[model samples]
Target: MTQVTIYTQNNCPPCTFVKNYLTAHHIAFEERNIANPTYRNEMIAHDAFATPFILLNDEPMYQVDMDKLNQTLGL
Candidate 1:
């Protein structure tokens, strides 16, 4: 199974959208909210300075990147 991790923040619409999209597709994922210092630092280390940073098997996406998301998840 593919491993998906999402770095998100509180009260972010795009973050919610991405989470919902993944859920709707039944794509299991690990959500790391940036509210925690560790997760925030991790996101920055990965060069993701925004909310809804997604990682699929360690590959990073800074935004929704619908094409890449669909292709990666085989949706």
Candidate 2:
């Protein structure tokens, strides 16, 4: 199965929006709080400088472009 991971921070509207959107679409994803120290290295290693950084099948997606996401998911 393909894995999706979202790197996000607390109180970020876009992050919440994306999470809700994914859930509404019945897509399962792993949520990582960038505020957490445990994920700091992972975030840096992936070069994610912003919140709501999404990874689809291990590929980095810096911005949440809905159209692109839909196309990727064949939705």
Candidate 3:
């Protein structure tokens, strides 16, 4: 089950890092790209205005923040 959501945009290195980190850890996640107008608003609504904004169990954060995210996900 996916407990992670990452909001990203094209050519953002941090976004790629977040995705690659998740993949490396075998963590499942839903990707929401801000390139989509709808998703841009969603990310802002969640108080994440940057690429690689991450949500773990509905808690908002930016970038990987593995320790915090893993804590939330009970990883």
What candidate 2 gets wrong by more than 4 Å, as runs, is none
Residue pairs clashing in model 1 are none
Give the least accurate 10-residue stretch of model 1, judged by summed lDDT.
Answer: 59-68
Cα distance off (Å), candidate 1, residue 54? 0.5
Which runs of model 3 end up more than 4 angstroms from their true locations? 73-75
User: Which residue pairs in model 2 clash with each other?
Assistant: none
* Residue 1 accuracy (lDDT) in model 2: 55
Off by over 4 Å in 1: none
lDDT of 2 by residue, 23-61 (tens): 998988899998888775687788888988888888889
lDDT by residue (1-75, candidate 1, tens digit) is 889999999999999999999999999999999999999999999988998999999998887899989988899
Best by TM-score: 1
Model 3, 22-71: lDDT tens digits are 78878899999888999999998987777888877787786567788666
What ordering of candidates by TM-score runs from best to worst?
A: 1, 2, 3
| lDDT-best of 1 and 3 | 1
Model 3 CA lDDT for position 13:
94
